[model samples]
Target: MSARLVLHGVCVGLLFAALAGAPTPAKAQKIYIETDLEGASGVYKFSQTREKDTPPNIEACEFLMGDIAAVVRGLRAGGAKEIIVSDGHGSQAFLPRLMEPGAKYVTGKPRPSSGLDETCDAIVMVGCHAMMGTPDGVLCHTQSSKSENRYWYNGVETGEIGQSAIVASYYGVPPILVTGDEATCRETKKFFGEHCVTVAVKRGLAREAAELYPFEETRKALFEGAKRAMAELPNCKPYQVKLPIQAKKEWYELDAKGVKGKLMTREGEILDLRDLYKF
Candidate 1:
């Protein structure tokens, strides 16, 4: 795994006009954004990420950034004073050029009590996908396409959103906005409440095929969802899961001819996930 990492935070400067009339700039609403490649707007298959010979992944990158940028705009429009966008997928190397100027970028996966603390007001996930074996999951897999087959937190089947939300809740940060394919939206709502806003950018037709919404419409909705979610932050309650949380997973990827063999696509048994929360 990579070391702990994050870029400088975006400083919320006081507007001369607003400060002149108000007691102080409104309390900064710190928002953390996590992003991935699959389920991004306009992405139809894995080659956009897995195969280098296809169209320049830059196109896909732009699609990914469009949604993220929209969310930031929405957050700011809804009165957010500070924002942090975590390059939560791949090598944590994507999105440097597209990150909003008003937000910081965390470059690596964050663990409990690490760079992310109790200060964040809400968590947002972009371009997320459903868990492995999801019939309607688009490019579905857990944190890894190869290495792990299944993941369970307290015996409940989950993906990145569930795992992240659990860790974030320890710091009292509830997930408020999630943008992805429709199946993932179902999963997000199942884990977080329906109050946690969702913006589905695509619908999966098969593992490698998806029917995406109009790029512009997806972006607009994400922005509006963030604005609405921020306005009702009070209703986006943190998902409180029982501690001493037991987790379960099965390991089969290693048995494959390589990381890309059948085992990578096959489902494995459950394993305890509680150890990850010992922190």
Candidate 2:
């Protein structure tokens, strides 16, 4: 429901010294960051994400905000001209007071898009999790963890990371950075390639269990990763999937009693990548 665009300036005179030799100064980069809650630092349980407004969930939102702050500061330090952060979590976890000043924050519900466009130089995924069925992915699930949803595009199983990148690709934006758990990092590498920078804050032991890293250490690493992502931007490419995509989604159907019943399947063709989540 609410979207705000805040602009901040960076020291381009020194930041782009590498291009100083050129006749004209290069334009500063604009980056869009998408975030989720399940993979946030210090959050590895469903109780922290599935429920909203609870003490555990509120604390988890703060943890996610801390991680975003680090990345936003790092992106600014890395010479980003403008930055936009979106709340990609299902329940929309965003604490405006705790937000970093360098970027605009997008939260609430029923938004038209992720606020990404062709003008964006790169996209970043923060606090993202692996797809369903990842044995070592802490709190991992696709679109709906409760329904046990799973998706396949062109016969290849894809997770939130890949799905987001695919949508970014529609706008010619490359995914340059991702931060989450070890399994999530692996998933990013598998889809976005090693050229994409990934920072893992924990090592997952199971869907609800993980070896969480200290917040201080993880924040430092996320900051460094954002810097590295700027440098890695050239090497990263937008993820492309052949279309019209043969899409298939499998999920559990809840009965009248609100209990999961038989598994349901939907098969269709996605003509537009922007509508990937809708399918």
Candidate 3:
């Protein structure tokens, strides 16, 4: 079997072993959950207003909080002791009072050092989309709202999921689960390997269209996915990239030197960065 298949098999085996053994470890597992509002179960257009130009919708905000609550419930059932849910989407204030009361909610735009990957045992990414330039990915972009469109790590094009995984790996935190659209899950696994459990709540039919599971069904899937992820934690390996990392930015305009690092790839991607900080 290929190396990837072997790794996947090992993860599965560990899940079965955990289920068959004595009760799970009594020690509490620290699970850090990061969520974006754009990829929630029924989200299509990210805007809040029904019209073209407005803020996010109130209903969408509720849906975002509810989905996060569902995941929190699942994490508790899966034996996660302490859960830290970070509002990782725009403004970082999408979910309000609906997250699990026990979960420590981190809202607002955090500093570069206060990102998703800190002193956490496992990381969970929710309501995320594919990277920039992915065909039909809903509201896809790397970090900034404009300018740099595509981001590359070690010459490979990656999205928010990739960057987050790299950060989690840097702190030796394994990404245990992710939930989003189908394309997001596939792309995340492509970059981080299949050790993480993913729930595809929607499939993007177009940039503004998608086939989504009912909100209730989406919640159920997220819960189950979290359980499986925790059960298989032992077999999950950290998504590791060698140090002395390089990053490349494909800007629509402007030269590459404006950012950090020298141009390594002929495609105008930058190289030799001083660690990836911030979302």
Top lDDT: which candidate number? 2
Against the reference, the lDDT scores of all candidates come to 0.75, 0.92, 0.73
lDDT score for residue 27 of model 2: 42
Q: Which digits, one per residue and each the tens of the lDDT, describe model 1 over residues 1-279?
A: 223222222122335555677864454378888788787898867767665334557678778888888988999998898888877667443657777677776665564424555888888888898888788888888776656467766668778778778778777888988888999999998988779999899999888888889988998899899898787677788777676555566545454455443442323332333334331
| TM-score against native, each model | 0.79, 0.90, 0.79
Mark the regions of model 2 whose C-alpha exceeds 4 Å error after superposition. Answer: 1-28
Best by TM-score: 2
Residue 208 C-alpha lDDT in model 1: 82
Backbone-clash count (model 1): 9
lDDT of 2 by residue, 98-117 (tens): 98998999998988766899
Instruction: For model 2, state the Cα shift of residue 88 in Å.
Output: 0.9
Show the colliding residue pairs in model 3: 48-55, 48-56, 48-57, 248-270
For residues 1-279, write the lDDT of model 3, one tens digit per residue: 999999999999998998988675654378898888777888887464232223456667677787788888888898888898887766554546565666888776545544455457788888888877677776666764344467766667778887777777767788888888998888877876777889988898776678878988999998888888888677666777665556566545435554443323323323322256421
Give the worst 10-residue stretch by lDDT in candidate 3: 265-274
Q: What are the root-mean-square deviations of the candidates from the true structure over C-alphas?
A: 12.5, 10.6, 9.5
Candidate 1 is scored at a TM of: 0.79
Q: How far is candidate 2 from the true structure (C-alpha RMSD, Å)?
A: 10.6
